[model samples]
Target: MIKIPSKRKRGVIISGQGWQRLQQAKRKMEMQGNAGESYTLEELSKITRLSSNTITKVQRRKFPVDKQTLESFFKSFNLTLIDSDYAEAIDAPPPVNRERIVLGGQIPLDSLLYVERPPVESLCYEAIVQPGALIRIKAPKQMGKTSLMARVLQQAREQNIRTVTLSFQLADTQVFLKLDRFLRWLCAIASSQLGLPKRISESWDNIFGSNYNATYYFENYLLREMDSDLVLALDEVDEVFHYPEITADFLGLLRAWHEKSRYGDGGSVLWQKLRIIIVHSTEVCVSLPVNQSPFNVGLSVELPEFTLEQVQDLSERHGLKWKVDEVERLMALVSGNPYLTQLALYHLSNEEITLDELLKTAIAEDGIYGSHLQQQLWRLRRYPELLADLQRVVLSPSPLEVEPIQALKLQSLGVVRVQNQRVSPRCELYARYFKLALAIT
Candidate 1:
């Protein structure tokens, strides 16, 4: 017997027990029908007649969905919706709770902490609808690039577009050893993500070469089979920068694809169905011809640091009644860095420490940022040239110039900001911490 809540709201959240029950049912169905493999979002959408974004919302449970949505979701598995399965969504607490807030990685889709950068999100949303759109989002690590990219994909999904995200971070070292192996890995993973069988062995050809074969697989198999336009997001693309051997080739392929869509390559319409979003932290380190580079062509977005007003807005979201002065004080040390600002507010909201104490210990080993500082220190130590250049910038009273590549790499690390070929420490905290850690006089 199931009971419905007397008062129904437009949105509901799944309870833990209900989620577990649904997962079990889904898995059982997968075993019976999908060869023991989990269904992809597209398949699930077809079964439930819900948009993939809606299905994702149900699974993440971070946002609310209509009660009727859950009923349809449950009905697909032949299960009845019960009162225990969900609770009406009420006004939830601000995302200041340490457990609820995602401190690292992409912010959850339902989070209140994500502040829109206005025209940036709007521009991306508009560009993604155009055929063969290439969106390049370049930002230092932890700068909310991934979060923004997620939002773009969410919008596409809501419009019944297919979205696939592939992170280079997931690739193993050996995958980069040969172009063929890397292409095969890429194709196979994409196939699995789309709930398609691994047909790489049959589709790949030694005679045609890896690049062509990879392109063929996508053109004839993946895109042709898809019912909706595909938004393929490749994240952490900087990982490929270290591998110069395949850098030119792989990036050139993307360029060619973009061109194909624009010019009707071979008069095939399939190429137009793909929209690509590439997220990298730094400029390309390897040399690529301007004509062969995807970076040169497309919608480029460079994420700027939060403005003072944005910082104040974020602080308020974290439940801090910070005035302009308090916000400015924090910015003096962090300079509107998004992750740093959010973490600071999270701590302040807990009343764990005063703003004064936080500022004083910010660069200290026992402070909230001690581990983060150490990690940056470790990365610097690995590259003697970067470490040496950063020491110069930190110790000098004025900004210094370093090798262009070194400046880009350091900026990517979020330790320095480069302007007009001059490099300076990103903030007071970075200067103080690295000056001490690097034994600079």
Candidate 2:
């Protein structure tokens, strides 16, 4: 927020709780290294989407009494005012629509819905700069895999590593038509991100070929050009798994690079300075050749859904004072699925609906989860074979044995769970909801 200085406005005093909450937010951000005069303040404001003036006032203890604005500012900084006796500076009612529930979406970095699961967060951090480290982040979608990857990248940035995030989802269909085009595209993008000149033309030899040329550019040119280690993060890597011809070679290249880091066999100078992070939903069909797949070799981190305690923390942040029973009831329905639990709570916090109503109508066309469920429904319709498999899985009284590939696909969608080769709905809500939705199939 660009500021134009004005005459000092009289500061409004507030209750101790109100002032304390503001102080906490200021202190936390300060601890996160946002205590500078201009730059830190701007970074903080950018993350929180709150005006720098609002943050300054809150710190001065004369924060404006706008409850929603104050709440937003606090939430952005991951602060929740204890709802006991806090009073606003003005005592004026906020507009009815002041706060909008973020029911469905990617939880932004500012409003990062992260519950630190020890070991996983620390492991990913450690692996990123460990020299040719291949950190594999595997989890179903909407299960905070991307969220965790974002944090990993942030950690790398703090370590002064050159970071580049490439999403295979961004690759056009034509790029995947051939192996050469795709590999060239990959190396070119990584080179551009590192601010290195593309040396493909000079490095390419008809004898050595495109893949080797890409390697030549990376190993011979780009890696030598780097002053610090480079962290190349690839998200949505599952997209490439569908192309077996490309998947084998590309994954092998990564594994080979990782090996080079440990022993500089032929030429490993720059290879050791490159760390790779590959994030994917482990729902792919084909298993790469034993020597080719990089999954088993690297540091693998699987993101589990939020636990009950994690939900409690998130609920408190939402300003919803609920008992343990309430959280459990919500959990029984969502079964710790991060997105669904969030959907139910966002409405509950706003008093738009009760927990019971959310669960009861969650799968309904007009319910909060309607659009999200419909998206899944559409995908299922594409693969009738998969739909038939789900139909059986959902209707069965107990977990049913299913094709391994189908099970992997369903589990990846967060629609079912596979235990001992038996498949069942992941949550009570899914069982009840999909049971009705897939009845006709």
Candidate 3:
């Protein structure tokens, strides 16, 4: 007797056979009714519970279908294969077309002109070593606070002063809750910047060692490890206020450091060797005593937006060929905002559109910048009463009757400018944002 090999049990497979059988059954069923016409891709997908692309692929027989997929297709169309004659004609779908582009991350500062305040490099060079003095930088959002500080740090490095710049923006509520952890993190950053060994240990009893006092630990550590005088620039210092205890503790420490430098046992040794600079987005509102406050301790430097001349210089630097009048017109539209001015210049540089065309396209319905304009409008619309107040002031041309808080918020948002008792829109950009806000709301 010839020994016949037993058929081996194979693992489960998901084939396109069931799909082919289902398609044939559906065609036959339809032919019996009124199936003289071929089924569209949409119709096939609806019947097979697969995407149009997938059905098209199966029709091309581009690849073998798995058993599970075939089962699904059959179940979706309610069909069963009775024989092997139903599985050979399938195809794959066409490929999708996609475009990929890399974007530049850094804004070219050379192409940017400074109109309001001097360039950061100039300010940094002008910085005199008044060891006991503090420099406070305040600005609205995106007004170049970080850029200026970076320039200052660069200048400090050039001047051979040891500089340690730290930003507290990433400190969340949890990190701020534990003062020790916060101090250690700050110290570690300072250590890294100052080229000192990281001596922070979990087993350490005090955050500051014996040689360094709690208030002047940072200064002490730097002076002990490094020979040069230190320039400590702290960014986003206002964030410390998010935790009241942390804010109080940090401010108190600053006060102690300030005192030790001025009147400590070393007779101006610590104070004369240290320069502290605190940069914030806005004036922090903490409920600390007046003497112990940051407001009392530093020289306030306000960062203002660019002027028309600066914007023109920036345009030229960016290789944008614009007449003086054209530059002025663009400034009128964007209100001398450095970022917006550069953005508008960028858009304009890519095309030969006229100023009027640019503005119309930027503000028109379904235009490129229209959505951004709409978003700005929606932010103001969220406060209807404020919008109403602004409109009333604009229409009737009178002084604002709203509270100081409301007015300040509007000013901060770059919407309104207040001079003496008169309040008006800052520029055409603000007027546009406000008008859109009113129209949409």
- The list of candidate 1 runs beyond 4 A from truth reads 1-7, 10-99, 265-268
- Compare the candidates by TM-score and give the number of the best one: 1
Tens digits of per-residue lDDT, candidate 1, 330-357, equal 9999997888888888888888888999
Please report, as a residue range, the 10-residue window in candidate 2 with the lowest summed lDDT.
Answer: 85-94
Error of 3 at 4 (Å): 77
Query: Which candidate tops lDDT?
Result: 1
Ranking by TM-score: 1, 2, 3
TM-score of each: 0.80, 0.76, 0.63
Tens digit of per-residue lDDT, candidate 2, span 371-408: 88888778778777789899888889989999998899
Cα deviation at 385, candidate 2, in Å, is 1.3
Output the worst ten-in-a-row residue range by lDDT, candidate 3: 97-106
